[model samples]
Target: MRARLMEATVELLVERGFAGTTTTLVSERAGVSRGAQLHHFPTKNALVVAAVEHLTERRGEELSRAVDALPAGGNRTRAVVAMLGDHFASPVFAAALELWVAARTDEALLAAVAPLEQRVGREAHRMTAAALGADESRPGVRELVQATLDLVRGLGLASTISDDSTRRRRILGEWADVLDREMARA
Candidate 1:
């Protein structure tokens, strides 16, 4: 039931912005009783926050599982970039984006999401570094990893308006080459 509610919440968050998503809609979508929904999540804030957290965790786990398939050598950088790019362009990213936008104006949401986003950002950085086999101890390498994440996130945001897949792939490919060179130099 909890999983169903969370899944419903994410779906609604993507289809309807945070302003449109509500406990009533989520309960109806989840096909769960209102009483049960309240028992699980006492407020709208609690439900959405929990749903986002659940989806984020699922995304992280998916990345970890996919990391094994990342190429082992020369093409590894491109593969990692491509994989992360796909991840940022996923529905989970859209749901998180809704939360981020909503949090900007809603103080209560900001309070709930700020720390969650911090943790999510840290995990993304750590995962990207690991996936790239990047040595953050080396100078400039940390910044490069951060840049990669920022670039992909920007690309994802752009994708929200239009299909940027062709341009995105080109940019990521070029970035992978540069990233390889920089990592080698570092």
Candidate 2:
């Protein structure tokens, strides 16, 4: 039931934005009573935050599986960039975008969302680092890994507003090339 409610919340958030995702809508969409939803999540903030956390964790698992499936000692840079592009274009990121926009104006929501966002960001960083076979002990490797994430995230944000698939592909390819060259120099 909890999972159902969270899933419904994510769907509604992606479809309707934060303003449209009320407790009533979520309960109805989840096919559960308001009472049941309230029993599990006492407030709208709690419910939305839980939904974001749930989706983030699920996406992280999916990313991990995708990473694990990549062939070893090949062009990991291109593979990682492609995988991240798919992830950024996903509904999970759309839902997260809604939350981020809402949180900017809503203090209560920001308070609830900040820690979860931090955790998600950290997990993404760690995953990117691992995918790149980054040696964290190196001075600039970690920074470069973080920059890759930032670049991918920026590309994802642009994609949310426009059909930038061609541009995104080009950027990813170019960035992968740059990263390859930089890593060689390092």
Which candidate number maximizes TM-score? 1
| Error of model 2, residue 117, in angstroms | 1.1
Q: How high is each candidate's TM-score? A: 0.98, 0.96
Q: Rate the local accuracy (lDDT) of all candidates.
A: 0.93, 0.88
The positional error of residue 55 in candidate 1, measured at the CA in angstroms, is 0.5
- Tens digit per residue, CA lDDT, model 1, 76-126: 899889888888888888999999999899999899999999999999999
Question: Candidate 1, which segments miss by more than 4 Å at Cα?
Answer: none
Instruction: Write the residue-wise lDDT of candidate 2 on 101-121 in tens digits.
Output: 999999999998888889898
Error of 1 at 162 (Å): 1.0
Error of 2 at 109 (Å): 1.0
Q: What TM-score would candidate 1 get against the native?
A: 0.98
